[model samples]
Target: MEKIFDNTEAALALKSDSELERARFLFELIKRDTLVKIGAAVTKFALKFRLPVEGLIRSTVFDHFCGGITEDDCLPVIDRMFSKNVHAVLDYSVEGKEEEGQFDKAMFKILKTLEYARHNKAIPYIVFKPTGFGRFEIYEKLTAGKKLTQEEQVEWNRIKNRYDRVCGKAFEYDVPILIDGEESWMQDAADELAESMMFKYNKETAIVFNTLQLYRHDRLDYLKELHQQATEGRFKIGMKLVRGAYMEKERERAIRLGYQDPICKDKATTDALFNEVLIYMIKNLENMALFVGTHNEESTYLVLQIMQRCKIAENDKRIWFGQLFGMSDHISYNLANFGYNVAKYLPYGPVRDVMPFLFRRAEENTSVAGQTSRELYLIKNEMKRRKLVKSV
Candidate 1:
């Protein structure tokens, strides 16, 4: 098998032969299409039948992906990440509806995460979605830059209050809250709202972070403009760079509307923009705190090189590396091992509510470049080192 990292010394620094053997066994299981199919089917059936799978899910993917069902429940896993020098971005993964009650629940949850984060040194950040507090359609409409009704405007005000409470709580606790990126149709509103919150809450420090999706053709430049705007306002900017989500939907919508697609022309273009964004952020490190959330080796390496050239500290508060909890342990653990600030976006919720997210992860791995293959290969390498494979 072709090695993704020929520098095996660097790659294997943290894992022993025994660990590698176990990884190989898991890799073989991950590589099988059958495992995902059976897993998804069982999960789907459990949801349909309303059978309890919390115990099973907790032992399987939940253990792999989530922090825990609650704050106190997550400490053991949080401590594990800390042992590896990985920070925790505790996520309350319960999706909220548009109703006022649900919005209140989400706000309370964010506040709770902040309160809990206050006492957890390993957890410096948490994430929340605007949709957790508002209707998607309302944000989609607002993104069209259309005028909103009094009622809609009032609702927007209430949404702002929700975020203000969350951010304030985080700030009082000296933790940060990341506002997640959402679908393109509603992304504009999300961006605008986050910026408004940043300008308000980011006065003394960057307490709120806005995720920027680089796949959009205009966003790289938009990031630059945002830098200028932040400079002008004299407020620190925080950005989390992601290649994108919603690619297929964006393409389909563009085709259906007889319009140019907003996405980059190709994956290479997206990658180029991602690296450029990192470069810009590194160059202006004082004015911005940047988080690179990627599994791409090239992008991750590029950030390291840039930081080295600029003599930035590995533990610089303005920079972070993040990976989803269940994936990319190599990058996360190794970088953390190297004394850089790294984090795992550890999500938590009940099984049914989180299934939507879980299924999407499985689907994405199956389609994404080198993801599942890479995962499987690493697992296999570990297993081989362990001599765990049975004779044919």
Candidate 2:
């Protein structure tokens, strides 16, 4: 780990001066937590009231954080990233839909993405939220060991069918699909379902990747147990390791419900757990594949160090480094420049439907200590370097 992420030239190679300035402006705005909250409220209200705010939103935060409104809209970005050896995972960013029709539509969108991935070398993977394919209540009910009514049972079967269909299509296309992690209450059902998919489609390799929110104290044990099961069943395991996004919601729910908090005690505990799991996965790379999704330079470096120590190739097909689009370009691009596999999570959807995802990105940048500041620092450094060169 020789300070690879500091190379801003490689990181910002794809951004023009105007695009760089836009990124700087976005991060500067995201640095103010109060402003982010107020903006989120106003944006929600505007969208709900059908105000003429889409243009403002699209020209600012939306363009910075999202790919476009549809899969075809994402082709240029995907091709540009691939030119630099970085891949793309086109995530449809719609959220909070629960109707069967909506679920069916989401499944169709994913199937289309899989077909695109089959033909496009730039788009190596596709992702979807479990709730996007089914109702949250169904997952919660199932996770709680509650029985479903006749109607609910039919809904559950439809959800399972959605999973099987998309997974089977992904397997047929030979493109890995990442199933995202959600709240702890609903995740048990999703985890069990992901395991079954892996067992069914991952006999030769890991085609179905489940997400692990490592912020939870128990997920390491869960991963270990899953690993043991995969070994016993003789199927490869695929996992995307993340620190989780729903910490506050999880805490509030546990407190309200009088249950144990699922999150770790503090940031340090979470970081330690993440590192421990990283090491464990690297050590057992033969039986599994990993997608390391983090913006933390130290954690990214930790993975690089472990890979080097283990004598793993820089461009290991079974391991990938991923960061969200419009964030952490330094990490994503620099890793790719160094011959490592990297992918940016390119979220695409209608401006209104994608607001929740954008708001989360804003909140995350504001909540995570020093994240926005680090991004600003890198952006300014690159801008200053370019200016000095011009003056010279």
Candidate 3:
């Protein structure tokens, strides 16, 4: 396994004592009943900072969650990972837009990232959210089966052109781009757009990767349908699968609308679907390019077994493993050691908008079983090994 459980190494190398202690403290704080309150304080502090959080957010969260403040600036980390045989998917985490100018700026930033990736061997992929460049309500209406108004359609076309530019750059440079999934309400539209892009650019290679949230009960079926469509169309299908993130919102909306929830009934259902789809892809590797993005040990190993069973090489270009930048060192680092293609989804941006991303990670750690406990356990172990006594 090459000791993928080297979070202790990543942590000790990247975080100072105060930074590690703060992570440990936040680890403790997030577990208590006062989590929301602690979250509020963290948000307040993040807003008070400058570009990077220098000591607090940058040293801990940014160091853990992002490659760097800028795409080019991330070279050291990117080089380090590539030296370990891990690749990267660059994510610009600017969010909550309300202006056309902001949208243009976001597009410019992403295009710039794509241009930079053309020269960087380690950066094979880049990701962006539709919400970053299009209005959420506009997409919700389109995905809700509503006809778009003239202005909305025009706006949609422009936003889509921005996507085309991103994909076109990727196609030009022979790099791949992964379009992130959005809210359940807007995912259908995202999928349609991503599918269209894939058909356009992925006729030869898997360049456009659409995210599939298996937490949705229908996505496995959707993956099957998409695979069929891609085969019939003679195009390669690319996918990044995750246990969906917005469970509470999906459930609440379903109940409010009095519809059967589209999400899986439980985590087990989602996990089962994820592994099955992964196996299906591994078996049909040539027709599909797979990015197995998860932290669960079995799911990660399940993909490994699928590749092995299918006689797929460890360095197969069609399959890669991924986990979010901050959270899953053991998965990515270890998988890379096994000579499999693996990467961290490294998010970078200014502090304010990135706070939402940060907050979500914290809450997710609290929600996921043993996530915090394991992190706490690791930090304490490393600290004790260093003979440093910590408070609480």
Candidate 4:
């Protein structure tokens, strides 16, 4: 049967033979659980002590997953994807710095990204983490209903100012921006700020987007509530939907704190909820702009099926699909090839700075059952086909 993800040539169009070989080797390592565990530990130790393993990592997982170590370095990757009809969302992948100076630097970097995106028609969106501009402790306290100290009040104001500057620039450039979702504890603050920005900048169009993680049992309802608010408020809602990245951390935290887990009970529940939200947003497409960020083939097929049933155009500006830059090219390239609106989340940063993001990608592949193996199978199939074509 023909499948949405069956177009291997479209998927691997931009990959060199050497790149495919590297991916195959990396996925093979990721598929071995014992090796992954040992590798993760060794990587952590080496990075902690500032060992010279950067070259090994840069050539392996980093090359497979990230765009490059700098904005200029990402131009070729961006141009290559755009050549295939896929757009880009430039994501600054730095994480886990809390100093005020660090936050200021991040804000400057994001604004620079937006400025760069302004001239590049290939870049449709810019994204940043809220914690990149504010302290996690401040968000946690705010979410918990605790009053901020006098110093924190000033800090919060600065955070708000940074958000306004970013959103305002996005609006000025007529480019959309995504405020990524984080842990449940700090999500409330992010949501509140995102909604406020949407109200300000999304009055005419969805210039500011908020992310919703559907792995939480409560998020589907949260989506419905936001739709209702948008209806009443007479503004558009821009939403980026994902199955979430912090499931294990969320569950463990709930267990440790003796509270009800906020996550869906199982993967099936999360999957059902994700599809339900997708359908709901599609049905309400008039007032909603949806960005579906997922690697799941079933979810991608579900969206295609619903759009076909609803007679939505393949090139609708209000709807888009996204996958991480280095993964899920089958879905991205195939959809783009067929004239669907698709973009890759192209994360870029210094090698040392993006290590956390890189590590998470590796851990996710290893821990998620069948993920690495599936990637390996696709690469092998594509390689065989290419070899056959050459021989002929």
Best candidate, lDDT = 2
Error of 4 at 376 (Å): 1.1
What local lDDT score does residue 213 receive in model 4, on the 0 to 100 scale?
Answer: 94
Summed backbone clashes in each candidate are 8, 0, 0, 0
lDDT for model 3 comes to 0.78
TM-score (C-alpha) between model 1 and the true structure: 0.89
Lowest lDDT sum, 10 consecutive residues, model 4, at 1-10
lDDT of 4 by residue, 48-67 (tens): 89999999989888878888
Global Cα lDDT for candidate 1? 0.79
What is the C-alpha lDDT profile of model 3 across 1-392, one tens digit per residue? Answer: 22346556544544466756766776776666367457657556757764344556666565666777777667787887777777888888877887888888888998888877888878878888888888888889988999999999998998888889888888888888888887899888888889999999999999999998888888878988998999899999999878878887889999999989988888889889888888777777788897877878788877776667667799888888888875655567767767888888888886566767767666666667776677678777777766554443
In Å, residue 46's CA in model 3 sits off its true spot by 7.2
The deviation in Å at residue 13 for candidate 3 is: 6.3
lDDT of 1 by residue, 1-392 (tens): 12234333344445556545554554455556678778788888887898987687666666666777777778887886687688888888776366988898988988888877888889988899889978887888899889889999998888878888888787778788899887888988888889988888888888899998889888877888888889889888999989887787889998998888999999889999888888888888788898888988889888888888788898988899898876777778778767888988998877678776776666556556777787666655554544543533
Off by over 4 Å in 2: none
- Superposed by TM-score, candidate 3 places the C-alpha of residue 155 at a distance from the truth, in angstroms, of 0.7
Each candidate's TM vs. the true structure? 0.89, 0.99, 0.90, 0.98
Show the colliding residue pairs in model 3.
Answer: none
